[model samples]
Target chain A: MDLRDLWAESLAGMLARPVRSALTTLGTVLGITTLVVTLGIAATAGNQIVGRFDELLATSVTVDVPPSSRGPLVSWDAPGELRRLRGVVSATALAQNEESSNLVVTANNLLDPTRVFGQTLAVVAAGPNLPETTHGRLLAGRFYDAGHVARHDRVVVLGEQAAAMLGITRLDHAPAVFINDRAYTVIGIIGDLRRERVLASAVLVPPTLGPDFGLKDVTRVLVATQLGAAELIARQAPLALSPSNVGELQVIAPAGPRRARDGAQDDVNGMFLILGLVSLVVGAVGIANVTLVTVMERVAEIGLRRALGAGRRHIAGQFLLESSLIGLTGGVIGASLGMAAVVGVAAVRQWTPVLDIRLALAAPVAGALVGLLAGLYPALRAARMEPVDALR
Target chain B: MPEPVIELTGVCREFPSDPPVRALSDVDLRVEPGDYLAIVGPSGSGKSTLLNILGLLDRPSSGSYRLDGVETTELRDGARTRLRGARIGFVFQSFHLLPHRTVVENVMLAEVYGPHPRRGRRARAEQALEQVGMGHRTGFAPGRLSGGERQRVAIARALMARPALLLCDEPTGNLDSRNTEAILDLFDGLRAQGLTILVITHEDGVSARAGRRVRIGDGLLTEQG
Candidate 1:
């Protein structure tokens, strides 16, 4: 038979049992839909995760300055120099006195003469840009600036937890916290530290009081860079801090987010792709089963065709074409449904949907291939019947 | 003087059962162009076997059967199928009309597998339907047609390829006397138009309408006077 006639025959055969054909196509639709939905959702979710990662952990770089025998390894003004480098959003130097954690702090020593409110709190001295470097917010008052550090003023910023513990809520009356019996005015209360979370429960003071607090040298410099510039900034921060002794400062920068994002996406794709293929396999089996049943049901028709002089290949071709057409139809429907599902879910969840154009185009062809394979056995079986036996 | 449409010599067909049943035993037959011949026999008389072998639907255990100058016994399956499609038309007792198709579409199916050009197949089908007086029912589905009408449609389908021979097996088995008489008259009309015809049936009335009749019993054939 000609191609046109073959196609017409297949179509007529399918239309003969409309409900069965539709049910058979449904199997392929589900398989392709799962494939498109999973891949699209994985891509969108992975991008969102990487975006959040880039905003926080991927941008922060810390340079740890270990204690050196040659006195202070990093100068207090080294943060200002590192901040001059490209891609650096903010940089701050921190010094913690070894005995500051052991100091007794009191909210009101004069009111409580028995020292009933004394508590041991860590005191960390930082540069003027501590709030910017740590991505922290000031809950009340203001942070100490360059003037406070240069003039050696005894002003401290209380961390959220520390301020609560010392019963200092309002700075209206110029609240003071005594550290080791030395009174220091509270300038600000800093909270919500995205980086250096340990600072949330400590007292932050200017670096000029490091010697008085027994902080011998600058301990670390916290640097925040622009997204995708963390690794470059990490390498350059040590050289910028102490050009002569860059080896003394250890820089800790997070691994690139691209690799992590790809790994996550691959894992997601692998898992869902298998499920899609399994569903496709099931759909293929459904087509095969239906085609076989159709072959069995049309035995007499087959015999009549043979008597009319249809070659075995022609009979097989007609059945194979019918199944493939069904698969193609299902694939198109499934691809559309899958994309719609992805977009719908993304819309509901407020995510930007991601779908590959190639995948969309390939889905139907893949479905057709599945149908072709599924119809092979049944078509062969139909073709193998002798005209005499079939007619009988 | 024209070549015989069918020539069968020493044709034998066997079924390999536990006892090896011989369906057609050394049956020899010949049919000329424009001939209307009938092979009549009761059940298990090898009538169907002879028809199957004549239509190239079955192979003889040992024989030489030639159709239209082609040694069909020596032909490959594809060649045999092509030859059959190009030369022979079949009409079964049950009509075998596709119920889902219109009468015209059923007629058109006859040329679908043949070597004929498909460009004007519908026109030809309509013309053949007209020849069998089923032209008016071209758009009607087979389910809506009477037994006589359905047989006429089958005849129209068989005539689509302009085949050299029309083969019928119990053509009026399911028809009432009136429809049977009508079908027998149609066969006579087809024969009058120079078409060779072969009918396999046990009915005396059906065989009496043919120009020649043969009797077969227990895998053996005998020409009737």
Candidate 2:
């Protein structure tokens, strides 16, 4: 018979043993599902990491003296030292003070001591491009202008969530807030920060707000490095800092959010790739076993067909078609289930489930290949059956 | 101007068993077009081997055989299969219709694998079934048919190819007397239609209906009628 008839007959025979066929296809499904899930999660996490890197730092470094080290406060005179280093473009020391208390955020409202930070307006080199609030206004005033910081004015900016919590909608009205039981007038709200790895919540105030919190000491030194040297600059900070103050020194690098997150993402992707490959191999083996059994079970029928004038290619095509169908079916079902699982998990954990082409395409192609390889031995065996012995 | 449909001379076949049995020895036979022949032999008399060689399903160890003037002994496997599909039709003792197919489907199977595989096989299969008095049972599965009805389907299948030689290897071996008579009557009708028929059997009833009988014993032909 022609190849089409052979395929029809073989498929009919396969359907005759529905349990066996389903069991055979299960191996491929497991393989493809593992592959899809592994690749999907890895890809999503990679995208998030890369997105975070791009958001946080295009090219800059921040240095901190951590609490673990015993440090007498080093003078903020290192701006010149940092400029002398290779690839150093510019530098500044930014001090931040945070104070928390139940405060009158609106006419009739009080807000919890969500984080409040103060920095020099000059230290925010990127202006509104830097992390800013996304919601209600820091009304009745403006952001910390150079004049406000120079005068040490009692001004505040509300964050998006902070502003929403305060129930303030009018930008023209000044709202009063209490920090460390001291009253400050709300000026401008920073709106929303870029949705990155960096904190998306906080209120911004002038460095003049420093003494309000106990942070009369230097909080952070924001250093701007030349493009492409941020990572190198971050690496060299510990060595250049005074040796005796090692305990109080920490280097924070603001890399292009995408690049920093990409590094971590590679590891996750690599892990999932290994998981996917292992399962695919197992799936291929399972398919091979099932196909071999199928060939053996239909030995007599194969012989009869051959004797009746079926060509060797016809026999091989029949088996290949059967296995490929099984693989394709399993791949479709498994991928759909995998996507559902990803969505379910993301919903439970409160994260975006990233869907992309690589994950979507890899499963069926890989599964189909596995099935073809699995069918290879069985198809060859069927093709090689001697019509004489087979007919017997 | 019609050609001799089958010719064999000094044909020998050896089976490589534990004792190395010789299944056929120096067999010489010929059948003209429209000949009706019966090959009669007891068990182990090499009748099956001779039938297989004649059917082009097996090659003789040392023989020069011609099928419709072509030297079949030297033909390659593909050429032999082509010849078999084009020129030979088989009816086995067990009435080996594919168990899953209906009567018409089984009959159409021959056309599916034959040299000139028929298109629109349904119409041709129905016609063939009618020729064997099985047209009404064409839709029934072989499992659902009686033994006699199944044999009729097998005969229909054989006739579907319209081969020059119809080979029957113990066609009535598995049937009751009524089924045997029915099959014999069908054979009588085919012979009248001028198809070359060879029926292999050890039963006298099978040989009596044939125009000629050839008896094989100890791998040798001893009598001809």
Best by TM-score: 1
Segments of candidate 2 deviating more than 4 angstroms: A52-93, A96-142, A146-251, A255-286, A346-352, A355-362, B17-19, B114-118
Which segments of candidate 1 are over 4 A away from where they belong?
A67-69, A77-91, A95-216, A226-229, A232-250, A262-277, B115-118
B-chain TM-score for every candidate: 0.98, 0.95
Please give, for residues A195-308, the per-residue lDDT of candidate 1 as tens digits.
888787888888888777788589988998998999999989998889889887899998899887797788789988899999999999999999999999999999999999
Range of the 10 consecutive residues with the lowest summed lDDT in candidate 2 chain A: A120-129
| lDDT for model 1 | 0.90
For residues A1-392, write the lDDT of model 2, one tens digit per residue: 66567666667656757787788778778777776776667656666566544433645577775433444354445555667889766655544433322222332334336533322121111112122211123333456665766687776666655655555455666676655456667676555344221221345556556545534445555566665777888877655655567555788777555565567667776776677677777777887888888788777667556645666777788888788777777787778877877777667766678877676776777677778888888889888876665655
lDDT tens digits, residues B42-121, model 2?
98899888888888778999988898888999988878877887788878777777776778878877776654544677
* lDDT over C-alpha atoms for residue B73 of model 2: 90
Give the best candidate by lDDT: 1
